[model samples]
Target chain A: MRTFFNTQMEVLNSELIKMGSLCEEMIELSIKALQEHQDFYKEILKLETQLDRQERNIQDLCMQILLQQQPVAGDLRKVYSALKIISDMERIGDMALDIAKIIKESPLEYQERLENMASATVEMVHLSIDCFIKQDLSIAHSVTQKDDVVDKLFYQIKQDVIAGLSKNSQESEVFINYLMIAKYFEKIADHSTNIAEWVEYSITGNYVGEEE
Target chain B: MRTFFNTQMEVLNSELIKMGSLCEEMIELSIKALQEHQDFYKEILKLETQLDRQERNIQDLCMQILLQQQPVAGDLRKVYSALKIISDMERIGDMALDIAKIIKESPLEYQERLENMASATVEMVHLSIDCFIKQDLSIAHSVTQKDDVVDKLFYQIKQDVIAGLSKNSQESEVFINYLMIAKYFEKIADHSTNIAEWVEYSITGNYVGEEE
Candidate 1:
């Protein structure tokens, strides 16, 4: 029984790592899609569907682990964290997919700051997953600091958009699209912050979702 | 043991119903805030915080129940459903709060259709919770239908905002704010649809998030 439980636990960990990697790939693909403001729907949609399947798979694994045998406190926390973190990660995928679909027909005037913001948000996703993989609180805490950079960049971009809005329908439309894309990136970072909190909770038995 | 488990389940059911009511109240208050275009921050903030606390309380109760006793298939589903539903509900609260904060300093041109959309979205929230309270799959199914109404309104408003953008910064800003607020209402409806799906899963043991 002990060996069987340990093996299942390892499977759970491995599956989450895979899902986390999928999230990173989706972010990268989304940024690439954003750079050209082109249609990457076929590839991006495949990743989004994979994300949903991955979430369901991990969900089933968690329920199986919980139902077959009673896990101790540590094992229980791990399962619970996987169950919670996948939703955040899945939302990250969905939002990135949303970013991909933005202004596909008519490419907007993309800002360099917007690309930097996406890069910053992507780093936060990477670090949060690494924290889960390595079980490191310091890495988990670092994701929070990185969120500050993303937020600052978002505000700057938002100010520029608001200030630059004009009576020209085409020009303002481009500005609005950029604003929406920036908000999506900001939200992606927020979801990463959520994963970091869940990682901290799984390791320490405490949760404080400090990202508002 | 069975009797104790049943009692705990009753407690769980009652707490969820309460949380569901808080969700309803938050939606209603947010709509009222939107119609008057006033800052309902204090009351809305209180409800949002209560939502977070309610989520934490229910989460603790779920972990307690899961840890203390071994539930069978049905009771286990009940716990899992509650765990999933609360996150969707809390997000509904958060999104409603986001709607409340839109264009507070500048009162935009209000659309009566937007109010109707908010009303329809609020009804969806009420009925989704009712499905959980009564374990009614029909009510759960109804939520999917209501989502169509919300979506239609959102698209109409989106088109109007897009077409109405002009060279005046103030004029287009209002339209953009209206667009953002409409999107928030659409998202609140989406979260309700998520709850409906969870309720369906809890009852029929099948999950289909068909609203998307």
Candidate 2:
């Protein structure tokens, strides 16, 4: 039974990694579509559906483990965190699709700062999942701290959009859409931060920055 | 043991309702802040913290029920749904605070269309939680359908902002801020839709709009 539980956990961890990679691909493809001015909406929508299935499968598996084995302490935390992390992963997929939709509608040339923001958010998603898979506390903490960079980039993008509006209000709609895209990226980073915080909770049983 | 489980479930249900009501209050306060151009940041922040603590307590209680009783079938689903719903509720609280933060920074006058959007979104939140508490499938479905109204209102607000910008390039920052607030309300409605979907899932074991 112990070995079986461990193997099930391994499967859970691997599935989570696969889902995380799907998120990374979706984010990359969305940005690529923007930078190259191509349509990736179909591909992103496909990935989003795949993520939903993955989330349901992982959720069922986690519930089965909890019901069958009734894991306690660290094991219970691991299962609980898996359940929480997948929701965030699924939201990240939705965020990518949102960006794809925006790009499809506007097809704006990617600004340098927006590209930087994209890369930063992608890195945060990657590292947060890595922290969970490896149970690396340091990496999880780093992901939390990295959210500040995304936040700063969002503000910079907002300022740029405002400046563009000030110069030529004709493109106000485009600027607002860009601002929305940046905000979505920031939100994706926030979800990554939530995953990282859950990772920390799984390891230390303490949610970072959570007040008593 | 059965009696004890029943009692614990009762406590869990009541706590969830309390948390849901807190979410409703937060949304109302956020809209009030915008309408009155008053500072509700402190109150919203306090509510956010309270929501967080409520989430922790409810989560712990759910975990206790699952571990102590090992509920299966419908009982298991109920506990799991509680866990998921609280996360969504916490996010609704965060969204309210996000709106409050924006209002604090910018203090844009409330437009009539925005007021309509706010009322629509608050109703969605209210109905979603009501569906969850009462386990009413029809009410849950209504909340899901009502999201379209909020979406339409958001687009209308967007168009108004754009028209305002075309007429006068100045105050573009304020218009953009209004746009962001409108977008936030749309997002809050989206979260409410999610809660409603989960409520349906808890009742029927079917996730509406979930493919395959």
Candidate 3:
């Protein structure tokens, strides 16, 4: 029975890494499409569906573990944390899909700040999952720190968008869209930060991250 | 043991209603503050902390229920759904806080569309909790429908903000803030919709609501 539970736990860990990679790919492909004037909405939508399925699959597995196996206190926290983390992971997919739609509708040339924001957000997503898989406290902290970088870039983009409005109010629609785009990327970072906090909580049994 | 389990489930139900009420109040107060040029930051902040505490309390309670009681499948799903719903409820508070900060920093006069959006979102929050408490399927479906109204008002607000940018680019920051404020309201509705979906899932075992 112990071996059976541990084998199932191994499946859970592998599935999480798979879901996390899907998030990274969707984010990267969406941002790449935006930057390079390519279209990836078709690909992103496919990935989004996959991510959704992943969430449901993981959720069912967690419930099965709870019902079939009597997880100890530490194991219970890990399973519960998995349930929370996957929700955030799925939101990352939604954020990516949102960005893809924005890019598809308005193919604005990618500015440097927006690019920076995208990179930081993607890195945060990457590191968040890494921390969870390895249970590395330091990596989780780094993901939180990366959120500051994403925020700074988002602020710069906001200022630039406002400046663009004065120079050419005709593009006001696009400018406002740019603001929403930056906000979405910032939100992606925020979700990743939440994931990192959950990772910490699973290990330490203390949820230190402030409410998202 | 059966009696004790029922008693604990009752306590869990009451706590969820309390937390849901806190979410509704935070959103209503924050929107009211924006419209009336009053500061509810202090009050809303107080409510937010209380909401946070409620989340932690409810989460611990749910875990206890899972660990101590050998809940049947139905009871298990209810406990799991509570775990998922409280996260969304806390996000409603976070969205309210985001809107409150924008109002405090910029103090934009509320427009009718934003007002409509706010009202729809608040009602959605209320209806979501009402539905969950009653386990009414009709109310859950109505909550999903209300999301459309909030989305429409958000679109109108987006249009207005972009138009405002043309008239006075100097106030672009505030205009963009209005855009974000509307998005936050839309997001509050989205979270409420998620809550409604969880309610449906708990009752029917079919998770119909799409990813957030």
Candidate 4:
């Protein structure tokens, strides 16, 4: 039974990594779709569906482990944190799709600041999931700290949008789209921080985030 | 042991209701702050902190229930749903605070469209929690359906903001603030629908909404 539980946990961890990879792909594609002015909505929608299935599967596995294995303390926290982590990850996927949808509607010209923000957010997503898979507290803390960078970029983007509007160089709708996209990326960064916090919780039983 | 579990479950349910009520109050206060152009950030922050404590207490209770009682199947689902519901509730609190923060930054004049959207969102929050407390499938479904209204209102508000911009009547920063407020309300409505979907899942074991 112990070995079985361990194997199931391995499965859970791998499944999470798979879901995390999909999220990375989704975020990348969303940004690429915007940068290249390609229609990526269908692909993003497909990825979102896959993520939903992954979430449901992982949720079922977590419940089954709790019910069947009756894991105590540490093991139980791992399962619980997995459950929580996937929900955040699923939200990340949704946010990526949301960005893609916006891109589809209003494909604004690429801005260097927004691109830099997107890259930072993407890196955060990668690092957060890697930290979780490795149970690396240092990396988790780093992800939390990196959220400040995303926040700064978001404010900068907001300023640029305002400046563009004041100059009347960009149409209101287009500039608003840029602001929305930047805001969505900021939200994605927030969700990545959430995942990293949950990873810390799984290891130390301490949720270190805004909620605390 | 069964009786003890039942009692604890009762406590959990009541705590959830309490948290849900706080969410309702937070939404109302946020809208009121905007409408009256008053500083409600401190109050919203207070409510958010209370929500965090409530979430921690409820999560601890849930873990205790699962660890001590070893609830299975339907009983387990109830506890799990409670766990998921609180996360959404906490987020709802955070989003309300986000709206309040924006209101603090740029005090836009009261617009009827925004007021109507805020009222609709508040009602959705109320109904969603009410559905969870009562396990009312009809009310839950109603909340899910009502999200369309909020979405429509969001688009209308977007249009209104654009119109304001085209007429060069409102400052770009001010109109952008309105857009953000509307988007936050739309997100709050989404969270409410999520709560309602969880309520349905708890009662029927069938998840609904976009994730499925």
The local distance difference test score of each candidate is 0.83, 0.88, 0.90, 0.89
lDDT of 1 at A22: 96
Residue-level lDDT for A26 in candidate 4:
96
Candidate 3 or 2, higher DockQ: 3
Give the alpha carbon lDDT tens digit for every residue of B23-69 in model 2.
99999999999989998999999999999999999989988897788
For DockQ, the strongest prediction is: 3
Candidate 1: tens digits of C-alpha lDDT, residues B185-205: 888898899899989988887
Candidate 3 has an lDDT of 0.90
- Local lDDT at B71 for model 3: 75
Which stretches of candidate 4 lie above 4 Å from their native place?
A: none
lDDT of 2 by residue, A32-94 (tens): 997898989999999998999899989889989988888888888889888888888888899
Model 2 pairs in collision: none
Give all TM-scores, in the order shown.
Answer: 0.95, 0.96, 0.97, 0.97
Residues B1-212 of candidate 4: C-alpha lDDT, one tens digit per residue? 56998999999999999999999999999999988999899999999999999999999999999999999987888899898888888888998999999888879887899999999999999999999989999999999899999999999999888777766733888899889999999988998898998888888888776531
Taking the candidates in order, what DockQ does each have? 0.44, 0.51, 0.65, 0.47
Ranking by DockQ: 3, 2, 4, 1
Q: By DockQ thresholds, what CAPRI class is model 2?
A: medium
Write one digit per residue (lDDT tens) for candidate 4, span A1-212. 56998999899999999999999999999999988988899999999999998988898898899899889888888998898888888888998998888888878888899999999999999999999888999999999999999999999998888778887833888888889999999999998999999889889988777631
Query: What is the TM-score of candidate 4?
Result: 0.97
Query: What is the lDDT for A205 in model 4?
Result: 89
